[model samples]
Target: MSQPSLAPYVLKRPWLMRWAKPLSKWYFDAAAYRKLGLRSDDLIPEESEIMQRAMKRLTPKESYDRVFRMRRAFQCSLAHQLLPKEEWTKPEEDIRYLSPIIAELEAEVTERQGLEAMVINKPNTKR
Candidate 1:
């Protein structure tokens, strides 16, 4: 299961969002994945059922792009070098691509479980 996050609550408040924005930015910047040309979503582990489902849902182009990024990142890291600054993933390009798919898959699983667990209640009158 996904960890509970205060993101929704913080995002709902302009003041909190404003306060957290730069902190989040700094955190991501420090992560340095952008320097290797990888988006944030590219770091998500693909070992679980939910992630596998999410992977299957990706468009062909998206899947190809994701693999390309991972390979490129791997090469860069192994070489102990970074992508050229111009080649680094742009702030706008580092958006979460797989997260929405994973969330959707998780929702589907939860809904299926709820439906399967549902019990029907019946009322009877003397016939």
Candidate 2:
């Protein structure tokens, strides 16, 4: 399971969210994946079963786009150059495409485990 995150906590408070917004933007910009034409979700490690399942759940077009971005990013990394600024992923375009699916899969796994562990009892019928 993914570790707990403070994102919800910060988001619930306007003051904390206001303070965090600029810092988060700066952090994402400094991370530089956007410069390589990749969305933040594109960087998620695919080594785990959850990620693999989430990837399989993606629409064909999204899957194709993801592969294209990864290849482009890989090429850019090898060439030691970023994509032209026009092609860089904009902040608005960096939506959480994969994360929701991953979360759904994790929830399903947890639900299945809970159901499997459930106990059943037989009613007494002696009269």
Candidate 3:
């Protein structure tokens, strides 16, 4: 057989070029900012005071849900770049697959917050 067309073959292989564009875009857009319902900075708190004020406006559960949804939307956009066009179109399926992982992360954040509160409440306790 004749020698294979190397460049064309490389592009055809999903594993080889799958992350090419998405990873590049991620590097370029490192800010993770979006302008949907509100301006990027408006939705995202820039300082401790803003975060605290926003948290006060939202109940604990509401804030958690709001944050989770925002995070998912961002994840979908990022994942779209990494996934093939066909896979990217089915965002619901992607969300289903990713939900558990997000939940685990959220739980970890909640656990860390609880630990911080405990430490603040009982400063003398090393444990």
- Which model scores highest in TM-score? 2
On the 0 to 100 scale, the lDDT of residue 47 in model 2 is 95
| Tens-digit lDDT track of model 3 for 17-52 | 776657745753454332211123234443554345
What is the Cα-based lDDT of residue 94 in candidate 1? Answer: 80
Ranking by lDDT: 2, 1, 3
Q: Give lDDT tens digits, candidate 1, residues 3-73.
A: 79999999999999999999999998899999999998998888999999899999999999999999999
Give stretches of model 2 more than 4 Å off. Answer: none
Error of 1 at 11 (Å): 3.4
- Candidate 2 structure quality by residue, lDDT tens digits, 5-87: 99999999999999999999899889999999999889889999999999999999999999999999999999999999999
Best by lDDT: 2
lDDT of 3: 0.47
Give candidate 1's whole-model lDDT: 0.92
Ten consecutive residues with minimal summed lDDT in candidate 2?
Answer: 1-10
Pairs in clash, predicted candidate 2: none
